[model samples]
Target: MEQTEITEILNRPYARELLGRDLTRLAYVAADGTPRAVPIAFTWNGAQIVLCTTRNSPKLPSLRRNPQVALTIDTEVHPPKILLIRGRAELDDVDGIPEEYLQMNGSYRMSAEQRVEWEAEVRSLYDGMVRIVITPTWVKLIDFETTLPSAVEELVRQRAERQNA
Candidate 1:
């Protein structure tokens, strides 16, 4: 898709809302050439989606083997709002917790004491983590009001044509 098309899709209000969501499913090709999809917390930092994971995560090797990935952020509802993105993943190893990780989990209702405990646990768990940063190459936003799945849209059009005929 053209950059203009991708920008339009990503810029939609519904798409922006989805990007603000806390979780997105990241899909990538596994090292053995199979597809793998996993739910992960992420943050949209204006330019890219940033996700943090342990250095020994199973997905890391696969990502190294195949950087091309797709991300889906959607809600479970009658007419779901979905933001679909295709991107290339780049791994960045960092020494400390990334700010995005904290921001993404900030919505959770945690008491002051609970928050401290959580932070301490996180600090002790890993010495370093890998940030999987994805810069989208293509994007599509599907909100029931503005867009539907291509197959369903086609079906609706076909039915209307038959009725007219």
Candidate 2:
């Protein structure tokens, strides 16, 4: 898709809402040549989607081997609103927790005291982390109202042609 088209899709209100969501299913090819999609917390900066993981994370090796990835951020409601993204993962190994990691998990409901405790625990747990950054090269939004899955859209077109016939 053209960059402008991708940007237009990402700028839609529903797409923006999905991006604001706490978790996205990150899909990638594992080292064993199998597909894996795991739900992980993420933060979408206007241009890129950022995910953080422990330094020793297994997925890191898989991602390093095959940087191509897809992400799905969707709602659980009927006629789910889904934003699909395709990009290449860029791993940045950092010495300490990235601020984006803190921001991504900040949406969880917690008391001020619990929040403080949680941060402390996180700080103590990981000596460093790997930041996975993906800048969307392609994007799509499906609300099932104005848009739909490609197969469904094709079926709709076939039905219309039959009616015309």
Candidate 3:
């Protein structure tokens, strides 16, 4: 898709809500040439999606070998809103925990004391992390109002033709 088109979809309100969500299903090709999709915490920085993982994460090497990836952020509700994105992964080694990681998990249920304990544990456990950054090259928002599933779109077209006939 054209960059302008991608930008337009991503700028939509539904897309913005999905992007702000804590978990997105990230899909990539594994070492064995199989597709893998996993739910991960991510932060969107207007231009790119950032996910942080442990330094020795296995996914890092897979991404290094093949950076192409697809992501889906959606809601589990009637007439669900879906946002699809395609991007290339760029890895960066960061010292200490990334603030994005912490922020992404902020919505988790935790008391003030538990929150401090969790933070301390996280800080002490990991020496560094790998930042998985992706700048979206293509994007689509399926909010049912402006866009629909391919099957539904085709059905709508057929119905219109029948009515015209």
Give the number of the best model, judged by TM-score: 2
Model 3 lDDT tens row, 16-81: 899989899999998888999999999998889999999988787899999999999999998999
- Model 1: per-residue lDDT, tens digit, 73-99? 999886899998999999999987877
In candidate 3, list every pair of residues with a backbone clash: none
What is the C-alpha local distance difference test score of candidate 3? 0.91
Write down the worst ten-residue block by lDDT for model 2. Answer: 93-102
Candidate 3 similarity to native, TM-score:
0.94
**In lDDT terms, how accurate is model 2?**
0.96
lDDT of candidate 3 at residue 74, scale 0 to 100: 95
Which candidate's lDDT is highest?
2
* TM values, all candidates: 0.94, 0.99, 0.94
Ranking by TM-score: 2, 3, 1
Steric clash pairs (candidate 2): none
Regions of candidate 3 where Cα sits further than 4 Å from its true position? none
